[model samples]
Target: AKGRSATIFVYGATGAGKTYTMFGQGEREHQGLIFRAIPEVFDAINAYGEADGHLEVKVSFLEIYNEVVRDLLQENGGGGACRVLEDERRGVVKVANLAEAPVRTPDEAQGYLRAGIRARTVEATAANAQSSRAHAVFTLTVEHVKTQSQGN
Candidate 1:
């Protein structure tokens, strides 16, 4: 189907290589799933070859800290800037007032990802000094619309 969407959920316990698997060790050539996915998305859109169609891609980063949803891309950590709610109209779970960053390139997407990673909630524990205490969710949305030619 054309207008379909998918989600890749990464979950694991503390120090279980979840972060490493999602976002490699920061090596340029040795990136992770997100880096690979970003380019693939752009490439797929480019391969569409729609002359009269417009495609828009946006990225949003959020984290659930102590069950509180926070927008990670916000300047001041976006604390309490958004809330997870069930949209009865859309019949799906949605985040209200989440900030979205329009990205045109994979680099741009990666940049936002880096910033979000830095804004994650991490705490030092006896087992792991820097343990992520929150669940980070990165969302990429793509919208495509075919434009009508003049007088059509």
Candidate 2:
């Protein structure tokens, strides 16, 4: 495909170092997968050097709790329960009413991720005092905009 996206998902059991490995255990020293991966994605895109237009990077964070999708980046924590609609005309699935933020650097992406994480739902159970009840999904959308003047 001339223009498409690349996606990766991270999953694991509770207390299996999923959150710690994905976002690090707080502190800036131990940067996690999201931090390292976002920068690398930009690096690869920069290296490819689009023959035409420019590139834009945007990120979206969401959590699926009890089968309900919630936008973690929305104002006041989350934007409540959202819907996953399939765009038949576009042939793609979209999350309605989700907050997608444009980021130019990995630092900005990290900031967005941290904010979303803070907004995530955490509860205390008999087994684990601190447990995340929702399944988080972080997406990095890279857009390559080619214009007619660029002579594709």
Candidate 3:
């Protein structure tokens, strides 16, 4: 599974349970995709049996409101808007000056996620009481390095 990549995009109309499906609510057992998926990733990494290798996981949360990109984990809601840029070297889109929190456990990841969610833009509308007025993106990056033997 070298150089593997995956993306989970959640989108729908207001009150369509999009937020619930992504973040869930109430009971801990009713955790959403972000919570559930993170643990699975750790489990998979552990199952890989990389005794001498090192694996690191980082998460970044952001929201796009009125074409402005904001970092959910940063202070004062990213302290302003962030720049969306294209990384020529990686050939991927990225947010400039975005904060990426390193997570070693699912609970750690959840903590950052909770903080970011609190910073997200949500409002009460006539149609949907609690409606998110922006598009949120949660990204998880995994970096792994395999240990090399001296004889190799």
For every model shown, what is its TM-score relative to the native structure?
Answer: 0.88, 0.84, 0.87
Per-candidate RMSD, Å = 2.0, 2.9, 2.6
Clashing pairs in 3: none
lDDT of every predicted structure (CA atoms): 0.85, 0.84, 0.85
lDDT of 1 by residue, 10-47 (tens): 77677887877787767877787887899999999878
What's the CA error at residue 84 for candidate 2, in Å? 1.5
Ranked by lDDT, the better of candidates 2 and 3 is 3
Report the C-alpha displacement of residue 134, candidate 2, in angstroms.
0.7
Candidate 2 segments whose C-alpha is farther than 4 A from its true place: 1-5, 87-92, 148-152
Report the poorest 10 consecutive residues by lDDT, candidate 1: 76-85
Clashing pairs in 2: none
Q: Report clash pairs, candidate 1.
A: none
| Candidate 3 residue-wise lDDT, 47-140, digit = tens | 7766778888999999999999999989865568899899889999978999989888888988888888888888898868778889999988
Greater TM-score among 1 and 2 belongs to: 1
**Candidate 1: C-alpha RMSD after superposition:** 2.0
